[model samples]
Target chain A: MKMTHKRRDMLVGLSFIAIWIVGFAALTLYPLIKTFIFSFQDVDITVEGIVTTNIKFENYRALFKFDLNFMDLIRMFVEEIFIYVPIIIVFAMMIAVILNQKIRFKGVFRSIFFLPVIIVSGPVVAELFSQGATTLPLIEQYGILDIVTNTFPESISEPLEKMFSEIIFILWMSGVQILIFLAGLQKIDSSIYEAAAIDGASPWEMFWKITLPSLGNLISINILYSVVTLSSFATNDVLRKIRIDMFSPDEGYGYASAEAVIYLIVILLILGLFGVIYLILRKRSVRMS
Target chain B: MITTWHKIKHKLIGRTITEGILYKVFIYLLLTSIGYIFLFPLLFMLSNSLKDIDDLLSPMVIWIPSKIYLTNFQLAFQTLDYFRTFFVGLSVTLLPAVLQTFIASLIGYGFAKFKFPFKNVLLGLVLLTYIIPPQITMISKYVLFTDLGLTNSAWSIIIPASFGQGLNSALFIFIFYQFFRMLPKTLDDAARIDGANRYYIFFKIAIPLSVPAYVTSLLFAFVWYFNETYIAAIFLGGQVPTLQLNLVSFAQSYTALAAANQHFFSINEGVKNASTILAILPMLIMYFVLQKSFVEGIDKTGFAGGE
Candidate 1:
């Protein structure tokens, strides 16, 4: 019996995606559900097998009521997303714009900028951080840290201090973002810039009116990428804590799962917040144009 | 004289269409400075790795060493168990990366070309996987893998990856989808008219055209897997020693080795720096070797045109 063309296509499509479907169910979906369940239960490992008790919201309650450190970690994570995302996006955009120009040794510059992405593992970065290689010594030598601390209030100064201390490492995180921005920058038609120029737009004016708006979608993409990379980094204190708590006799799997759930929710919230902001800005840009 | 000076200023700072000398200099200066910032840590690592005990301690010596230091490298080489761990690292990272890349290509081809029910939803699900942190599922995956006796072995990584759930697999699928979608449908249609089956058309037409996607995805997968320690540490159970895992325990390993040999030299910054350098050396070499494709492949990945 011959199948209809539409049916044939559908079957073929399903066949192609069959492995992914199975994988998603087993590896992603099942585990996701299991994690959710595990978060509410008191999970224990026994000699015979695994065991769980339904202790709904107890793990979460304990986390909020007792875990002060978890709260601090969450605050730091949110602060990092707020501080690092814009800095990375802006730095990446700046470097990408420069690299996109008609310049000599562009390849050399590009390779140098992208070097960090290749070698930035958890251990390598941890070693660098331990050895004080991640920071620029000049910042200390030049007393920029002192000035910033003195100038700003504690709330502002704290993040500023972090920014100064890990300045190079922060810049290192921009390697992939730079490449992403560069790709976006390259795709912009030069004719638009030319037309704007003909209409008496200065370079600065062209950047704001044409380049920035054209890169609106890319800005959001970069923001998402930066947030994910920063959050999921191996050496993240919160992740490290979760991993530690997983094996602790007092906490076990349930508490750790609860922490993971909270972390996931926070990440989703950040992404949602960014998505809303991006949509609002995009709408404004469209209306303005 | 005033008119001449004004003319010179205009020439030095060209209009929007053309970059003038001042602008060109400014661009180069900015690029060079930022480039320095990017290379600072690497330079610091290299310089410190070469420093001896005296040079490391001495205030006079900053960027350069007083004398060349081979002892640190020797010590680091021993501490890392360099050769054995390197291949072990390859077994987990490279093998899984290859499997992940191939599977991602097939899945991407599916999403790109085929018009099927819930296609958009499925594709959205693929991206949703990327957004979901691996930690959320890791606990359950750990339990599952432990049950299957896949823990502490490469199978734990390889199995998930082969099924298209590896590290950053969704991004690769998206990349291939972008690449395959960009290919003209006429080629596939022509092949079909000649009585080629769907699989035949895909294998012949689609795979051949998407070399850039494959290369880009493979490189990224390899690098990501190679660098991944959190998941590796959890799943591998520290029985399988990758370079990254080894590096994490470098100090302990060094102490243990020193005790075994009964040679008591305190672990110094130079030795630690050397180990760090050694850990990243392979990836750094790979990046330089594939420098062009590494940079240019970003363009081919169609990252600029997001869904």
Candidate 2:
């Protein structure tokens, strides 16, 4: 009896996918479950095996009450997300539009802008900053720091300086977003623009009516990517603090897992906010058009 | 100057120089300035690496060094044991990167071409991997790896990737799926009509057409693996130091040795700069060499965001 074509295809497909199934089960799914289990327990790893003692909400309580410093860090991270995500999205969109233009040596400019993505790792940036090479020397030479200090109160000036530094870092992080937006821009059919122009659409009108609406999906993707990447970065002191506690002598595994779980929730919450906003904007655009 | 500018502008924009030459100039100016900001770190590293003790002390010395010095590079190279660690890094990175790329391609092809049971669920599971922060899973994984006696070995990195579960493997699969799904079904159908087996079709047709996906997965896998010191520290520990780890540990070792020898020498910023520069040199070179395909890969991988 001839095997059904559907069965044959399914069998072949399963064979190809079998390894990933096993791998994901072992690497991702299993570990995820185990992490959740470990979060509520007092876990100790020895030479022989893992020893898990099921406990109450003590680890989590400690996470919130005494250790982890959850509230302040989470608030700061949320604020940073709110501040940086929009800036990165807008900045990346603007740069991508410029790069997408019929400019000369576009490849050269593309490579230059993309260089940071390849080379800017945590240690490299930390190393550079340690050596007092964080900002351009020209800024120092021009007494920009002095002017800023004089202009603002100390409370405002400190965060202002930090915000300025973060802008540079966020600009660096926008490389991949720029690439994504550029690709999205290229995917828009030129005929749409030609039609708009025939209907006497100004460039400004075209951008508002056509370009922004067309790029709606990409903007959401950029926001999600930026927020997620920003949160997971090793340089993120909140995550770093959790990681440190993970390996530290007193807290060890369980406490870190609790912190990790909380941090994970925080990230998901932020992602959900952006995701919902994206959905609302998409709905509005559809209704308007 | 004004009349010539006006004439050129009128000819070009049909109105004013404000919208023509000035606009173009402003764009170039903006691009150059932002490009400089992006280039600042590398420039800072390079210039600082070449600065001597005297040049470093002189407040006047900034962007360009007064005198170029090779001593820092020489010292960092020696401390890092550049050759030994280079081979270690290559071994750890190359196998995992290549294996994950191949595995991702195969899995991605499966999802794209075949309508099997729970296909959507499986694909959703893959997306779940991307969303789940690695920190939560990392500790449990350490416990698991240690139990399996895979910790502190290159296999800790390579074995997971061999099964298509390496770093950002989900993103790789997403990219491969996007690339493979774009191919016309006629090609697969024609091959099948000729009695080509599924494996043969995948190898001969699908794999061959996926150059962009392959490059995207491979290059990114390699770079992420190379730069990954955190996971390496957790899994490999101190057994095998990849180049980045070596660069990080260089200062501690230097201080220890200097203290042991009772030397008055202090760790200078120049040497630190040199280590960073050298550590990132390979990635920099790879980016420049594969610049065209790299750009295309990045452009293509944007679809990983999905509709």
Best by DockQ: 1
Worst 10 residues of 1 chain A by lDDT: A1-10
Off by over 4 Å in 1: A1-3, B16-18, B262-264
Shift of residue B214 alpha carbon in model 2, Å = 1.0
* Each prediction's whole-model lDDT (CA): 0.89, 0.81
User: Could you list the chain B TM-scores for each candidate?
Assistant: 0.96, 0.92
Task: Single out the weakest 10-residue window by summed lDDT for candidate 2 chain B.
Answer: B11-20
User: Candidate 2, B303: how far from true, in Å?
Assistant: 3.7
lDDT of 2 by residue, B1-307 (tens): 9999878767666443224666788889999998888787778789889988888788899778887898888878877878888887776787799998999999988998888999999998987777776766888898889889899998889988888778778878888887788889999999999999999999998888877778887988898788777677778887887778887787986676568654325678888888899889889999989987777776775463465
